[model samples]
Each structure stands twice: as structure tokens, then as C-alpha cells.
Target: MAAIAQERYEDSYLYRLRHSAAHLMAQALTELYPGIKLAIGPPIENGFYYDVDSPVVIREEDLAKIEARMKELSKLDQRIVRMEAPDREAAKKLILEETTLGQGPEVAEYKLLLLEAVPDGETISFYDQQRTDREGKFHRFLDLCRGPHVDSTKEIKHFKLMNLAGAYWRGDAKNKQLTRIYGTAFETKEELETHLHNLEEARKRDHRILGRELGLFMFSPRVGPGLPLWLPKGAVLRDTMVTFLKEEQLKRGYEPVVTPSIASIKLYEKSGHIIAYRDKMFPFMEDEERETYILKPMNCPFHIEIYASQMRSYRDLPVRYAEFGTVHRYEQSGEVTGILRARGFTQDDAHLFVTKDQLIDEFIGVVDLMKTVLDKLGLKDFRARVGTKDPLSDKYVGHDENWVAATEAIEKACQTMGVDYFVSPGDAAFYGPKLDLIIKDALGRDWQMGTVQVDYNLPERFELEYIGEDSKPHRPIMIHRAPFGSLERMIGLLTEQYAGAFPLWLAPVQIAILPIADRHAEYAAELKVRFRDEFKLRVHLDDRRETLGKKIRDTQMQKVPYMVIIGDRDIEQGTVGVRSREEGDLGAMSLDAFIERVKSEL
Candidate 1:
């Protein structure tokens, strides 16, 4: 069902509208900035972007001017017509002549390069937006694009020019950088307004900003760009999440294990990562003995070595090893964004070695665990993506038969679990097929979260075997599952999902005790200790010399779930004033009663 929905989106009218919007924007750019070199422009998931090497600098302030021009062009009712070239030479001639609009051939640099990249015997096409004015004047904007655009630019009335970004031509760092203009279009004005509204909300909920405001984490240039140093409160948040997952794993029969941060390079070579994942790995390190080592990019290879160390019978077939293993990757500086795409992070990684007959049940169990994790994290809107190997790609390591079997196993598990899933080709890991959880947050933005993979190639490569019912050794299949994906990323998403106001059970500081005056400081400290020792809740005591209103305001700003007020009346009456983060102040309640309320929430 999800796969069909995704297909519908690809062929939807909104897709064509956005495609035409890109062309309209390109036309506006050319008219506004003559002799600019145009590159590729395509419709994306949310909008469209056009890459151009402009003669003049393009900045955010220039977006309104470009948008005004687009409006004029859109109202002109230009008919967008598609034309095909007879051959590559004819395509180049059309580009240099029609596309450049009398500008020198130098302006068609990127277009000619795009033409050369097209494979032989494929149709080369262009979309030409042409109009004839009532005053007997003619105008046309021709672009090298394989487009399925709307008939007329008049339909692209509801659109907005978003912003500007620097993108390297063809995404290569070594290539010349070009200005990328991003814009969005919609079928209705209401949708465009709502999208813009959401963009504002997203800016407020950005995790990087919230992390610092909430004292969760920070990044220092001395350490690096993609590495985060967890603050005190942030460490508590991480520990809380780790405890929850560890307890759940124990209940599900997962044993804990630990691994080193670095390993011999030969391990990755055996796992086929050296060939497939080398680009993401850091530079190789060598010791005095000349043996090469690498910062581990993944934990599966380490777990495999532990499994291969022992020879076992059918009883120990399904061996599960769980680890909160830290791994490193070499993300491009531009691609790193806060903790979401950190260079070094810990994965809640686990691997299950099971017999072929036990594969289905084990896979189903892994999926169930993932569901429980999402539910606990307050992420309810989600769908599964079954990532399978692209048939045309040579990067995969497994045989055709193994790939089919692995892919089939995942689909079967999803069906059994009644999971709504879509099949996405070319999204799979090099060795196997997997199911990824795509979580939709409060802002309606999708995040790829927990994942489960079924692999037969790794066990085959490592020769992992177990004795079967027939008393013969048989290769076992491996299941890789990570519920939280990574601690840093999950926390980042949660920080944004709840806008830093975490639930009572998940918040680093569950309650704050705010004393009205210095005279009440001793009582506030006592309550804090009681909350921490008896109720086992995280609590903070604000005994600083401040007014009651200021103390309450400061505690509220921290977004604590509950605040206990200490004053003369409460101290004498053996009661506490309670304030809720969402609701206003509750007049007064017994300390035991408040503890019960917090327990119920947990």
C-alpha cells in the first residue's frame, strides 16, 4: 500500500507543476542575469532547484526580485513544448543557439557537458517555453531537460522562491561551485501558505538550536565539526535512553557485549566494506609494526569475529550480541548537520545468528522490538521501507539467489507483522536487504530511524556454521537490528519532535523545586532529596536568592515536566504547590500525591 502511494506521488499533478516551476525559475534567472551558465534543474521531494553560474552574485535578498520575474513569466501564458534532437551534434547546436539566446557558446558549458553524459541511442530532448506578445514581439526560453511539464506556465501561479545555497557542480568538491536557487510550487494557495508556515515552525524546532538552549549538547571547533560533546544534562538524557533500551533488550533475551574502537583493516576487507564503504571511512592508520588499522565504521564485523570464535550445535544457533558501540565515518564537511549526521556516534547495534528455519521468527521478533522502541519514544506516525539492491548496480556483494531470499524474508516478516511498507530500490546496504523505519515528526517531516537487515553473505564470508537436525554443518543467516539507529541521532530527532519538552519519563530533569525565598531553601532541598532517593525521579532544587515569580519563570524556561513550589503555607500545611509544564499551576497537593501523579505518568 505504501509503495503504491509513493508511486502515485511520482506521477501526481503536483510533480509536474513543480517541474514546470523549475523551468519558469530558470527562464527568470536568464532574463535577469545575462550570460549566466545554466546547469541542471530538477524537481525534488518538496520543491525544485536550479543550479547556475551567474555572472553576478546571487544572495538571499535577491530571491524576491527573482520571484517577481517568475510571476510575470507565469502570467504570460507561455506554451511549454518539448522538442527532440536527431543526434548528439544536433542537440549541441540547438543548445548553443536556442538555449543561449545569442549569448556566446561559452554560456552553454554545463549544458554541453550534460549532453555528452547521456548514453548513446537515448532520446535527447529540451523544453521550450515560448510566447508571442500582442505588440508583435516574440520571446522563448529553451533549456536542455527531459521534462514532463505542465502545458503552460500560467498554471504555475502558486509558487515561492525559497532560498539560495552553494552547490558544487555535479556534487563534486573539486568541481566549480554554483549558486542553487530553491523554490516550491503547489496546486493551491493554501498549500503553499501551509508549507511556508511549516518551514517557520521547523526553524524554531531545529535541534541544534534547542540542544544549546536546553543544555543537551555542543560542538567545538577544537574537537571537530561533526563531533558533539555531551553536556551534563545531555549525558543524563543519553544514560536514560540507554537504560531503557538495555532493560528492554534483556527482557527479549539479548546479551550485552562490548567491542574496541579500532580494528585490523583486514576485517573490513573480508566483510566487503573496503570495496563498498571505503569512501565513508577515515584514513587508514599504521603502527610501528606496519600493521594497518581503521576506526571502525561498523560493529557487525566485530560481532562476526566473536561468533566465528566458537563452534556450536543447533541449541546455540540463534546467538544474539548487543552493543552500544561507538563508530566513526568521514562525512563531508558540508553534509554534517549537528548530531543528526555526526562523524562519531554510538549505534544501539545488535546481531542475531540464526538457522535458516529460525529466520522468519527472529526477523519478526526484531520488527516487534523496533515497534516498541518507536512507541516509547512517542513516534507514532511511521512507515517501513524495504531497501533492496538495484539490479543495475555492481556494488552489491551477495549472489542473486541470496539477495532474493533475503529480500523475500523481509517482505514476509512485514506481512506477518502487518507493517505498511514501500519497496525502495538502490537503498539497500551492499550486503543485504533491510527494513527501515521512516518516522514522521510533529512538523510532518520524515526521518529514517530504526533498521533491521537480513544477511546471508556475511556468514558465508566468515564461514559461520552450526550443526543442524541432520547432524550436518550448515551456514547460518545473520540479522542486524538497531532500534534507535544511533543515540546521537535519536536524541536529536526527539529534541526536535517534542521541541525540547520531553515527556516525564524521558526528560533529563523530571521535576524542579523552586523555593520562594531563602527561608524556604532548606525545605526545597529536603524535597529534592526525597524525590531523588524515595521516588527515584530526577529533580533539581533552585535555592538561589530570587523572587518567587523569577524562580518559577526560570524553572518553566528549562521545560521541566513538573515544578514544586516551597512557601510558608505549603511548609506549614505539609503540602506542595505543583505546576505543570503544559497546564498552569495546581494550587496545592500532598507530596505523596504528587509522587503518585509522576509515577502514573512514567
Candidate 2:
């Protein structure tokens, strides 16, 4: 418990402030609405939120009233004092005594719930905000807390209430619904302002809004909730990303393979995903012979089967198989968000089978590849997460020694590469440990984009082995990696990251040829063919009757990187005026110069 607290303290300063603010928020709510019952108040990433059960429904108008009260208490500069109780009975008696004086039975009930859940030998602590006046000492308001709170409420100077939503108690669907209030807090006003501004920027970059405005993608109620339909323009963007990754993988000795969308359920059972991920998996279907088949939620098992298909030797120690494997998982309705969290998506997945001696070197190679891909995509802000085994849980397979070795291998790889990373225990797959990359977008919001896992359990479970130089059968170590994670998710994040302005190489329409008048249409068409044939550029001829300004606006809205405008002067001069999305018009230039400029960018 001390270790956990130390780790939390090292990772976040906002966490302490948010946790303290939760206690203050609860105190303010109890004062404003006397009969409101409290559920749970926990600190989240950006701030803290408390759940309440009340007879009177909270409307939007009430938020300001509550917030004003919170501000008032914060101004009091009350000292936050932490106290420990002997046991559960003492904790319950304290709450009951407070209720008799004027506090509600709700506090007693909440205290009782906490006492029942706390483990034996664990210290039960509470925090109080004490106040005093010239005449006498004012009373104290307290709440159950396991805290590392600031010394005074003055430390909580920057905060705001964000929103309200209904949440199930304890996150179980069967539990009673509680009104959850969400808010954010920062250490300083500047940080708070920056966070709020980032939120606004994220709203503008929301893929659903951009997708509708740019005609990139769509979701239909008739089709499904988490499934999306890619429009013509979106398809081009998706294909471009896939092709880029494929070319990179090919250059690194990865062989592409295709697999079925659905496989026999028996395959998953063997892979252990059926046992561990049963809740997230879709229902199975039975064929005429009553054999069950399921939509693949992961591509690891299939890739393992492919590796096992051939008898490999020490010479073929590291066999890397790559695929653009599409998978399906059953996400709850509330959990579904745009393309970021989808039911079906394509993963740029690859699995490497290597000898035990080759594990560290192979892992290093994967890290290098990930860096190259992320660099190409302009995702420079990312940190690695070393997901390790859960000691207390039986969810993972493999011997203890193997798990230790795999975790150390990943840690060594990170150290050797000189990258920042954090360890996340119990975050690994049941089979083995992994390295997950968390990336922040332009709005300063984080998203997990890539993962690389080191597995010893799967090879053991599948009995995967290779002949050593001594001609003895030895177990092989498997490295599962995907730089993009998923095509759908990467595209969605990239869309928002770039704010719909993709790079020249990744843009669906690289160049749009706009003719100022009908007389220049022949020249624009001829130029389009030449660009397509010679430069392999995605070029479109705008032959519509719309004016040149309107045509430029339309193509700009589509996020085309370049626009080639041909008019009387350009036709006569054997040159075309070039306009860029990032840079405004570059005066008329020869076709050769235009191609050279674009080639340099690619």
C-alpha cells in the first residue's frame, strides 16, 4: 500500500488536488442540498467526480449554484486535517454522531459501505476542513478518505465543474443508477485555462463532425452502432495508410499473409482469449454440422497457427508474418465512440517467432520500426507502457520464470533504446507482458496507438518449437507487434491530430486540377493524365461549371494538398499556377518544377 501511494505521488500532482477537491465538493453538496445521499467520489485523469442519489433531480441551472458554494468554501482557506479511526465500528459511530447533530443518515450509510469493503489491517482515514471565527471555533465537515491532501483549501484555487451523467453504482449494470458529476482541476490557473482550451479544440476536431463536413465516413443505424461506412474519400485515405505501412513492413523482411474473418471457436479456446475475453467476444454461430465459429476478435491465434504450419529450424529463428487483419469485438453500447473505439477494425499486425537468444534484439528491431512509422506519420509525442504480469491473478499462463524473463527482456529493450516508459502491472495479456505506446494528439489528449507484446505462454500453449543447432527441440519466443494498432482508430486519431489537414503523401486527393474556364479544360485534363502516369499522383480534373473561386473552396474543404489552376496566361506560357494547403499561391511554374517539389515532399 505504501509503494502504491509512492508510485501515485511520483506520477501525478493533480491527483492529490483532485482527490481533495472531491471531499470539498461532497461537503458543499451536502450543505446546499441537505437530503442528497452520497455514493462514491474518485479522482480521474483530469479531475474528480462524485456520485449522488437524491430525490430532487439535478438540473443544469443547479450546477452554478453548487459551483458558487464550492468557491465560497475554497475561499475560507480552511485547513484540511486528516484523521485515522481505530476500526470500522469507530468509523460508523463517528458518522452516526455527526448525523444526530444535523448531518443526514446518508453519511452514516456511506461510511458503513466503506467499512464493509476495506480490507483487514488497512487504516481507515478521514479528512476534515476546519474553520474558526473571532467569537468561537466553527464546526468541521468531514468525509471518509484515503488521502494525501494539500494542507489547506487555498491550494485548490483552480477548478471547474464540467458535466453530469448517469452512472451505475460500482460500474455494474445491475446496480442502482446514480447521478455522477464530472469536473476538472489543475495546480495553477494557467494550466486550467490551457486544459479548457484544449477541450474546445478537441470539440472542433471531433471525427464525427469532421467526417460529416468532409464526407469522409459515416455510421448508419441500420448497419450497427460501432461499424462505420467509409466514403470514397475516406477509403482513399485508409488505403493510403495501409499501403504505406505495408511498404515499410516489406522493407523489414515481413511477409504479408491473409486470413479468414471468422474461425472455429476451438481455435480461440486454444489461444486462451476465449477464457479471458469471453465477455468482450461476440456470440458464436453454428454451421450445419453444429460446429461453432466466431468472428475473430484478435489475429494472434491465427498468426500462431500459421507459424506452426511449417517445421522451422534455428536458421529460421525470427519469422515475421504481417497482415492487415480485420477483427470484431462486442463493445457495449455506452462504450462505443466513433472510429476510435469500434466493433470492427483492421489491425496492421505482425508476429515474430524467434529463439530465446534473439528475443532482446528482435524486440529492439520492433521498437526501431515503430519509431520509423510514427516519425513518418508525424506522431512525435508518445510514451511506452511496459505492461507486466499480475502476481495475484491466475488469468495469465506460463511458468513464473518465463514471465520474469519476458518482462525483463521488454524492460531491457526500453533501456537500451533510451525511451521513456512506465510499468503497468495487471495490464498485460493473460499470456505475457507487452509494451503499449500512448500518444497525445494536437489537443493534448492522450490516445493509445501502438502495442508490442512478448509472449511465452502462447508458444507453450500451442507447443510451438524449433530445432536448435544441437538438434534438440526448444521452445520459441513470440513477439506480437502492431505499430498503427488499427487502421480505423489510427485514421480517426490522425484526422483529429492534423485537424483534417493530412500530409501531402497521405491526403486522399494529392492534387486537384482546377480550370479557370472551359478553354483550359483540355490542358487540365492533359496535365492530370501526365501527373497520374508519370508522378503516380492522385490527380482530379475539376470540369464543373462552378467558378474558379468556388472550385478552390470546394477542394480546400476536401483538404486537398495542392491545387493547379490553369488559365489563359498559363495555357499560353506552358506553365500552371500552384497553390498549397499550407502555403498560399506559388506563381506559375513549369510542370517539371511542380513534380520535383512534390517528389521532395514524398
Candidate 3:
């Protein structure tokens, strides 16, 4: 976790404030709805939420009444206290008697089940809120929970009840559905206001909305959820990215190879992915020959098969294979958030097989390539994370010595690159340790954009070998890397980062030529051809017979990087009125001069 996020979780009082806020909301809901049964309430990222089962439906408008009631309750200065029970029976009694609030033992159904799930030796704790009113009437609210709550409810003043949704109990589909109320609390009013404002801006900049509006990409109901169909503009964006990365890979001496989209199930079994990554994989397919095949969820296994195709000598020890392979994973429908978390996406995948002696340099080379890619993409605000083996996790499948060596290789690579990174345990791939680049987007949200993993297990699993100079068979280290991660995901991030107004070189339609009148249409058409054929620029010509003003408006809305206006004044002098998306109109310039300007940007 980053420092600010870590502090917010462990050190800052906001966590306690948010936790207390959840309890406060629960108390208000209990008072408002007689038959409501509380399940669990916990503080989450940016806010807190409570899940409850209510006999009466709570509409969106009903939230105001609930918030009003919460405000009235907070001012009561209710003292929040935590109490622990000695045994399971004592916890059940507390839940049945006090936590139910005279609504009956049936209301304590979820809490009782929660208590049963707790281990035998663990302490059963509950939070109680009580206050004495002016009439001297004692009022209290209690819930069966393990909590460290704020001393009083007054501290939860700056908070808002954000929204409500239906969530299954414990996230199990078979479990009964409950009403989930989400809210955020802040120490100061300013912070809460700022968060709300940013949320509004985020909604505007949401990639799904902008993706379609900007004619970049779209999701179809017929195509099913999480499957995106790239439109013309979107395809152009993908091609531009591919061209750039392909050239970079070629420069780095990576051999391009194409692999099948579906492979035999045995491939994954040999790679240990069937056991470790079955959940993320699509359903297996059985062919006529009784062979089980699965859609490719990863490209590494295919690359491995290629490397082991032939016996290799020490001179051929370093084999780099690159592929823009499309992978399909079975992401849950609800979990898929547009292209960001899609069921199918392309990976800028590659694997470098090298001798153990070349591991450090190969790792460093991969890291350097990643840095170069990030720099070109203008994603500078990123942090490196060295994902090491978790001491507690048995999920990792590599030998202890191999894990240690691979982990050390990644850390040393980062050190030699002079890039600071934090060690994150359990973030490693099951096969080995990795270096993940977490980039902060324009919205200040962190996205895992790229990764480079040092793997020893996969090579061993495949029994891959190469002849060393000493004439002995030896194992090779594998450096798996993808600087872009995926075309869909990276494009999604870039769309939001630039608000669809991509930089000049990246813009799908680099320039739009608009003719002022019917007489100038030929000139505009000629210019478009010149820009496309001669200069290799993505250009669009507006000859739709629309008014000049309307044409300019449409062009700007499309977020074209540049515009050339041709009219009688420009036609006679052989000059074009040039306008840039960023600088607006740049007066009039000759065609030769315009070409030079465009060359500077490219």
C-alpha cells in the first residue's frame, strides 16, 4: 500500500470515524425500519457500508430521511463502547437479547450465524451505542461485532450516505440478498466536498461513456458482457499502439511469433496453470478425439512450447519471443468493468529464456524496456513493486532457493535501474516473483499497467534445457514481460487520461480538413489525400455539405488534433489556415510549412 493509503488504514482516525459512521447508519436504519436485520458493516476504501435485510423496500429517495435521522442521532452524543463476551453461549445471549433490540431473535439470525463461524478460542465482541435524552429516557443500539469504534458519534458529523445496492450475504450467490447502504465519512467538511466533486468529474471522464461518445469503442448486448467491439477509431488506436511497440520490440531483438488461440489442456497442466489458475480460466472443451482444449488464458505456455521445440546450445541460450497474444479469462459478469477488466483482451506478451548467468542483465533489459515504454506513453507517475514470496502462502509452487534467487533478481534489477520500489509479499506470480508497475492515472487512481516476472518454475516444469559451453545440459531463467499489459486496458486508461483528446502522434484522426464552401471541397479533398498518402497522417475530410461553422464544431467534438481550413483566400495563395486542438488557429501557412510542422510533432 502507498503511504497515504496505509496511513488512512492504520494510523489516521478516519478509519475509526468511518467504522463508527457505519454503526450510526445501522442504528438509524433500525429505528426507521422495525423488521430490518443487520448482517455486517465494515469500513471500505473511501467509505463504509452496511448490509441489512429489510422487510420494507428502501428507495433512493428514502435515503434523505435516513440521513436526517442519522444526523439527529449523532447530535445525541451517543457513547460508543466495545464489550467482549467470555464464551460462545454468552455471545449468543448478547445477540438474541440486546442486539435484537426487542425486535425478536429472528432479527439476530445473521449475527448468530456469524458467531458460529468464529473460531472456538476467539473473543466475541460487540459495539453498543447509548445516550440519555433530556426526558431522562435511556436509549441504546447494539450489534454483534468485533470493533474498535470511535468514543462518540459526534465525531462522525462530516459524512454522506452515498448510495444503495443489493448484495448477497457473504457474497455467495446462493445466499439471501440484502440491502447494502454505502456512505463516506471524512474528518473535515472540505475533504468530503472535494471527494464528491471529483466523483462528478470522474463520471464525466468515465471511459465507458467517453469510449462510445468519442467513437473509440462500444460494448454490445449481443456480444455479451465484458466483450468490447473496437470501432474504426478504436482499431486505429490499437494499430498505432501495436506499430509503436512492435518497432520497439524489434529494436530490442525480440522475435515475433504467432500462436494458436486455443491449445490442448495438457499445456496448462504442464505449466501448473490448470491447478493454480483454473478459476480464471474458461470452461474446458472436449474434442472428437476426447482431447480437452481450453481457450488460451495465457501466452507464456505457448512461448515455452516454442523454446523447447529444438535442442539449443549456449550461443542460443537467450531466446526472446514476443507476441501480441489475445487471452480470454472467465471474469465474472459483475466483476467485469468495461475493457479495464474484460473477459477477453490482448496482451503485449513476451518471454526471454536466458542462462542463469544472464538472468540479472536480461531482467534489467526488460525493466529498461518497460521504462522506455512508460516514458513514451507519458505515464511517468508510477511506482515499482517487487512482488516477493509470502512466508505464509503455500500457493507458491517454486523451490525455496529458486524463490529466493528470483526475488533477489527482481530487487537487484530495480536497484540497478535506480528506480525505487517497495517489496510487496504475495504479489508474485505463483511461478515466480515479479515487478509490477502501478501507474497513477489522471484521476489519481492507481492501475496495474505493466508487469515483468522472473520465472524459474515454468522452465523447470516444461523440463526445458540448453547445452552450455561446458557441454552440460542446464536450466534457463525466463523473464516474462509486457510493457503495455493489454491494448484494451491501456487504451481505456489512455482514454480517461487525455479525456479522448489524445496527444498528436497518438490521435486516431490526427487532422481534419474542412472546406469553407462548395468551391473549396476539391482543395480539402486534395489536402486530405496529401496528408494521408504523402505524410502518413490519419486525416478526415468534412465534405458532408454541412455549414462551415457546424463542420468545425463536429471536428472539435471528435477531438481531432489538428485542422486545416481551405477557402478562396487560401486556395489562391496556395496556403491553408491551420488550427491545432491545443493552440486553436495558427493563421495561414503554406502546405510545405504545414508538413514541416506536422513532422515536428510526429
List ranges where model 1 is wrong by over 4 Å. 1-4, 8-10, 102-106, 116-122, 172-176, 392-402
Model 2: worst 10 consecutive residues (lDDT sum): 1-10
lDDT of 3: 0.89
lDDT of 1 at 183: 96
RMSD to true structure for each model, in Å: 2.3, 3.2, 2.4
TM-score of 2: 0.92
lDDT of 2 by residue, 479-540 (tens): 99999999888988999999899998888889999999998999899999999998899988
The list of candidate 3 runs beyond 4 A from truth reads 1-12, 134-137, 286-288
**What TM-scores do the predictions have?**
0.94, 0.92, 0.94
Compute the lDDT for candidate 1: 0.91
* Global Cα lDDT for candidate 2: 0.86
Candidate that would win on lDDT: 1
Candidate 1 local Cα displacement, residue 64, angstroms:
1.3
Cα displacement (Å) at residue 405, model 1: 3.8
Please report how far candidate 2 places residue 570 from its true position, in Å: 1.7
